[model samples]
Each structure stands twice: as C-alpha cells, then as structure tokens.
Target: MAVGVPELKIERVRQNYLANLVAAIACFLLEAGWYSAFMDTWINGIGRNRQWLENTGINPAIQYGTALVMASIMATAISCVTQLTGKQTALRGIKVGALLWAGFELTTLATEYIFEVRPISLFLVNAGYWFFGMTLMGAIVGGWKKKV
Candidate 1:
C-alpha cells in the first residue's frame, strides 16, 4: 500500500483454529521438556526454581494458562506469515520460522539480557528453545494450509 510494496489481494480463511491449538500444545510441551532438562543450570542462573515459584504462591494454572496463550499467539502469527509469503510446506515454514527467530526473538531477547547483565548461558538456553520451537510450530502450521 505504500513505498516499494505493491498492492495485492489478501485472501482470508477461517484461520484453522484447530491447527493453531495443536501447534500451541506442541510448542508448550517442547518448552516444558527444554526447561526441565536444563532446570539445574537455568534455575541457578536465575536464582529461582520450582520451589521458589511455589513458595511465592504462584499458581500452576497461571503458568500453564500463560504458556497456552503465548503458544496460540505464535501459531496464529506464523499462520498469517505463511499465508502472506505464499509459503507452503513444512520445510518452507521452517525457513520462515528461522528468519523470524533470528530477526524478532533473538534480537529482542539478546538486547534485554545484555542490559540486564544476565549471563549468556541463560540467553542461549532461552533462545535455543525459541529457535527450535518456532521451527516446529512453523512445520505444523505450514502443513495445515499448502496454499494461501
């Protein structure tokens, strides 16, 4: 609509809510495994752990609910991106997901951690999850709609 962009028709679909839910669950489970495997180092780095969260009176429901919400948002966003780019297939989605991880997730998280003086290990752990998780989500969502 402006600048070097050309006008094009944007097709709208129901957006596949079921696919989004599946992707969300997949990513959430992946996150859980990732954190669990690295919990010792991760918790020491943050000086926090499961007991800390519980002692603070944080509800497990809140944590899970937040994860679901975030995963759903990621799924929907990837779907839109795939549709806009005319990208089909899980492989294509993986590429898009990588680019997004590099451009958006990596950049933002790195910047925040740098300022906070957090260790690079922490950043690597978190960013590594996003890197793989985003690609996995893209693969699932990409396979859902082969074409825009």
Candidate 2:
C-alpha cells in the first residue's frame, strides 16, 4: 500500500465494508476447502480420525458464525490498512496479507502446535491457508478500492 492516501472518510469506510465482507467469505471458503482436502491428515495430526469426527457433534451455528465473523474482521482490517497505507491496490493488499498472515496466523498456529505437540503437517496446512487467504483478501479489498 502507498503512504499518501487521501483522508479517510466514514462514507468510504462504510463502502469498503461490503468489499471486506465479501473478501472474508471468500477467504473462509478457501479455508474450508483447504481443511477438507487435507481432512485426514489434519484429523490424524490432532489425534483423531474419520470415525471420531463422524460421531462427534459440534454446534454448526456457532462454528459457522465464528468463522464468518473472524473472516470479516480480518478482511476489514486489511481494507482499513490498505486505505491508511495509501496503497489501495491489489498488489498492496497482497503485501498486507502476507504481513497479517505472518504476524497473526502463522504465529498463533505455531504457538498452538508447539504447546500441544501437534504435527508439522497441521501447522503447514493451517499456515498455508492463511498465507493464501490473506493475500487473496488483500487482492479483493485492495483491488476493489474504486469506490473508496
């Protein structure tokens, strides 16, 4: 992102909210695919298997809602940063995404895995998803800066 963007405005932030929302959803979907594709590996890493997951039940509503909200917040934060940095471009978004991924996603997962003695594969899968997801998020939020 640039370092000399125009002054921020409420209207502009509001306009970008939609873009952030959409990006978040896309990122979330990417996450779902990533996990699904590597489901067996992930489950095994966490000391589980297909049979366990099939029997274990989670609150779908809470899970989906939490995921959605997390994605939305991430996208919105990226969008805001893109504007503040004065680099409201897809490329800038990618840069921001990488930063966010490293700063937040990678760090968090690494810590969790380290403490839990989780598999490297699990970390790889989770980290990879955030890296790509954040970059794509930046691309979408930064690319769609026309309105803002």
* TM-score against truth, every candidate: 0.88, 0.84
Model 2 regions more than 4 Å off: 1-15, 146-148
lDDT of 2 at 142: 91
lDDT of 2 by residue, 48-138 (tens): 8889877778877788899999889889888877777775889898888898888888889899889998889988877888899999999
Candidate 1, residues 1-148, lDDT tens digits: the string is 5899988876764477888889899999999999999888788778788798569877889999999999999988887787667746788777788889999999999999999999888898999999999999888888886344
lDDT of each: 0.85, 0.85
RMSD for each of the candidates: 3.2, 5.2
* Candidate 1 to truth, TM: 0.88
- State model 2's lDDT: 0.85
| Candidate 1: pairs in clash | none
